[model samples]
Target: MERTGRMETITYDCIREAAARLKGAAHRTPVMTSRTLNKQSGREIYLKCEQFQRGGAFKFRGAYNTISRMTEEEKQRGVLAYSSGNHAQGVALAARLSGVPAVICIPTDAPPVKLAATRETYGAEVLTFDRLTTDREAFGRQVAEERGLTIVPPFDHPHIIAGAGTVALELLEEVPDLDAVITPIGGGGLLSGTSIAAHGWNPKIRVFGAEPKLAADTYRSLQEGKRVSIDPPSTVADGLRATTPGVLTFPILQSHVENVVLVTEEEIEDAIRFALLRLKTVIEPSAAVALAAVRKGALPRDCRKVGVILSGGNIDPSLLAQLWEREATKI
Candidate 1:
């Protein structure tokens, strides 16, 4: 299958190169399987556990892959990026590993644990913005220009997409016969990468994107055949609250993804609880979006073997109180 008019720079070759670059830097996070997951979904479910990834999320792959390739002068100048939380931690950690400085802009209301981890744990200079009022991309660019810092976009860059593709690349290498793959979409980095890797490995494999229904920008974009910006989401999945898809990623997702699954906040919370209680693992709400889709039968019935990426586990352990206030489920 010839992929014409697709992202030119992000091929299987590029993804393979990223895998090579990430060999030692990124953890080869395990492919997890559970009888309970299989029974709930009625399919052979392979869970790509990225919660165990460096920086406690898969964003480190792209952050390191992008920042590590910078010129010596650029590394000395350092990098700038904006995120709600996970990408900031990834960039801060990667910069530390590379012996460079990183400036991260995060939302003021971002999870306290994530904010602390980005600032104190990873040792990045942190800036806060009102996510509801400020445009983060514009703010990041302004700061980068003033400080002469290199910009590391959360997504929309070829290297980021290729780096993210490595997750699916590793998964397919371990489980080549999967009938479908699902990943949560936030500006489409992970989903686009997963689509490229999954289709590249086996063109027959189905690819799906999962999103919280409250933050249904990607869903609306796919329907209207262009990017759509919604009001800021009040969804529990804070990490997935992008109002629109990336300019580059939207096209890749439009081209390759089978469909986008929109799940409710309740379903997402249920998945979080399910993972903790039954699966004996921790997953944040954003990661739980993918699981909610699978466990709730949102995929096609023909998908007998499904692969799901549990994207992160950066939720504050205390957040369990807010999520399960009435119930007595303790982490």
Candidate 2:
């Protein structure tokens, strides 16, 4: 990848500082080695189970890091955000923890469980919009203007990226000799952070991003040497459905990430099943993309002892039921 010269400054030190901020706040999610994954991939696989992290996803790290840093006046005025689900819940929880009111703009089509969790579970005000016909960012900004709320976007902000990097920071600290790290990419924050953290630890460590083939904007963006936009994806991995890479995140990703791999919808579903039945962990479709890419041979041939971030485990009840129905039919 060519140097874009427009990278915002996020060094290993930034990630370390974020880690310091999150030390007591965020969960030090466990790192597990799956025998079945090792056997199938023919390499030792270290799975960083971020699903077990607070709010049932890694988004909590970013949300808490961002919201906790707000000024007292800003906290009093509250925060606003837009996300499909996990980030909404993360921000909602973080805001509540900081005694800051929050208003979240979510797509009406987002999973019902996520909606309920954001509103009823976390007590954040939930506003719904038509994701298909509306621009969520513009809407969020408009609302922020009207209400004087500070915006904490899903991925893109420097603090968010630094906080997300803590996932890799913890992974590398726990498993120091890993050859590479791979994680799902939505708007590039996680991958960008992962890349920086991995390379910061050991410049030789390769970093990769996984995306649904149906929602491969980052992959296309990396290939074209510029950010690319896609039509809103219809993939089951709803959380991975960003139409474009964030402008700020793209340059960091292009600088450090080795490649962005695309996985099919079938691949993602199979990964979900594999996690439940074989690995004995429940992961949502968005979280399954990294494992699916690995199973699809997305890693380098020489790479061994790879760390995979299972980004979240917030599957909607309806989707889990559908998977169960299919499993029973196969039986």
Expressed as tens digits, the lDDT of each residue in 154-199 for candidate 2 is: 9988889989999999999999999989999999889988998999
Whole-model lDDT, candidate 1?
0.92
Clashes per candidate, residues 3 or more apart or on different chains: 0, 0
lDDT of 1 by residue, 110-148 (tens): 999999999999999999999999999999999999999
Model 1, position 59: C-alpha lDDT score = 94
Superposed by TM-score, candidate 1 places the C-alpha of residue 201 at a distance from the truth, in angstroms, of: 0.5
**TM-scores, all models, native as reference:** 0.96, 0.97
Give the distance in Å from residue 132's predicted Cα in candidate 1 to where it truly belongs: 0.5
What's the CA error at residue 303 for candidate 1, in Å?
0.4
Q: List residue ranges in candidate 1 displaced over 4 A.
A: 1-8, 329-331
